[model samples]
Target: MTLNRSIGILALICLPAAGIWFWQNPTVRQAPQLSFKTIKGERIDLADLKGKLVLVTFWATDCPGCIEEIPHLVELHRQYSNAGLTIIAVAMYYDPPNRVMAMAKAKQLPYAVALDPSGSLAQGFGNVQLTPTTFLIDRTGRIVLQNTGAFELQDIRQRLNQL
Candidate 1:
């Protein structure tokens, strides 16, 4: 095939792939009721967390960005739990329970870390491509803000204050 034809075919292949990826990954419109087992092995239902400011962050154990943001999340939970905030870290990819426990212990995370071994919860929340996606749900259970990447402490604080 000619160089121009080869380039055209490559573009054709890449364009559809990009489109599919973009279509499959969009900001979550409605929050789904996710039921998962916490690292402590207790079943928790997302609907049970209503009437509180909840941060549902989807992350994976191997994600560097997710690892880096744990401390910030811990701080947010610490500063605001007394104010009726609930932060739940939903692990999108499966890892050994020990690893999850160790990371939580090392960071001294005060919030609950749940396991989404099948990643269905992550997909339901429109966080297909990224780890560390955070959704802020108000007391009434409406998603007020959805962040696809790592967030700053100030941003989290401001969002919490608004709730």
Candidate 2:
């Protein structure tokens, strides 16, 4: 094949790969304007947390994955809370407050735990319907990461460190 033709073919292959990488990875986006009232009666507004790195996780008490992730979240909170990291675990509207509170107590979660009784929190976050959906917002209020399933703790830690 001619050298020009070979170069053209390589460019075509690489362009799609780059596009896919961009599509699969996190992109800069503004976080939704919302306020959360924690089960502890602490009102946390996103605007108030503008200069902090926040992790807003949507979870349900009954979800096995969510249940399994509590410890990790707790540890993350312990490790980074003092370093400007704020973690909020939000219980789905379907989950009764009693159950949510019980799980929080049982898990000994140290972060703010909010109850989405009206589902407005979920709706504001792109109509999230999956348990363990997490949004990592930077200090500037831009969502740097959005994971809909189980997320790697190390990856989160690295991102947190980078921020």
Candidate 3:
């Protein structure tokens, strides 16, 4: 092989290896520092939950998809909360606090229901603009998964198991 051709081949191999190393590095994708104010006047700091797997879900009361996922989320919480999974359902800034509270009550949500009235929570989570944006963060505070809309519950369960 020509010198340039050999160098090109080496570059192709090394670049992908470097990319994979960077992507897989746990320190590269840490979740942002954020604190949530739950509906019942409770403060939850993400940093405090470092040793626990956390599922932070951005939702709106008026969102059909968000509403649809509640039952599955509730079940997930039921099955996993005792296994060190903390689920936080965040109501978007545009969602009225009263409506969020009413839905939380009506649905009998078992997990923490937070209010994002100023949209800061969404902003901290990569400026999330859509309802039902969910993030699965590992015990070490690395964000393992980010889903924009509806997600597969089984897949989430598998991930939770692995984490």
Candidate 4:
């Protein structure tokens, strides 16, 4: 193979490998402070959820993968909330606010939902440029996992089991 072609193949292979490593063994990161009003006009903040495991997801209404993840998120919240788990779904700025709100309502999502007008919230989470990115934060308010794309639900549950 040509040198450039070889390098391209290697990059394609290694980049995702690195992302998986980052996702599974995320270094402890102090979660970016978050405070926002939900679509239901309820205010929420990470600080307020101290001592609770939290999952913050960045998504858009038009993203099928994001839509696919909602039921899993709802299940997680319902099963774990009393045990101190919290979830916040932040809708990406490009999606119309009305549609975002509609999706949350139609799904009857059990977690907090916030709309980003200009993607600032996603930027704080490492400039999330895609739909369905998720971060799992520990009870101590540090991010323990970061997954982009269609995150495996079983993997997430396994990680939570560890914590």
Per-residue lDDT, model 3, residue 138, is 94
Candidate 3 residue spans exceeding 4 A from truth: 1-28
Query: Tell me, what's the RMSD of every candidate?
Result: 10.2, 2.8, 3.7, 8.0
Q: Model-by-model lDDT, in order?
A: 0.80, 0.92, 0.91, 0.88
**Ten-residue stretch with the least lDDT total in model 2:** 20-29
* Model 2: per-residue Cα lDDT at residue 88: 95
Residue 39 shift from truth in candidate 4, angstroms = 0.2
Number of the candidate with higher lDDT, 2 or 3 = 2
Better of 2 and 4 by TM-score: 2
- Compose the digit string of candidate 3's lDDT tens values, residues 59-96: 99888899889988999999999999999999999999
Q: If ranked by lDDT, best first, what sequence of candidates would result?
A: 2, 3, 4, 1
Question: Candidate 1 residues 39-151, lDDT tens each?
Answer: 88788777888888888888877889898898898888889999989888987766666788888778777898987767687877764658778888888777777777887
The parts of candidate 2 lying over 4 Å away from their true place are: 1-21
Clashing pairs in 2: none
Candidate number that wins on TM-score, 1 or 2: 2
How much lDDT does candidate 1 score?
0.80
Taking all chains together, the TM-score of candidate 2 against the true structure is 0.88
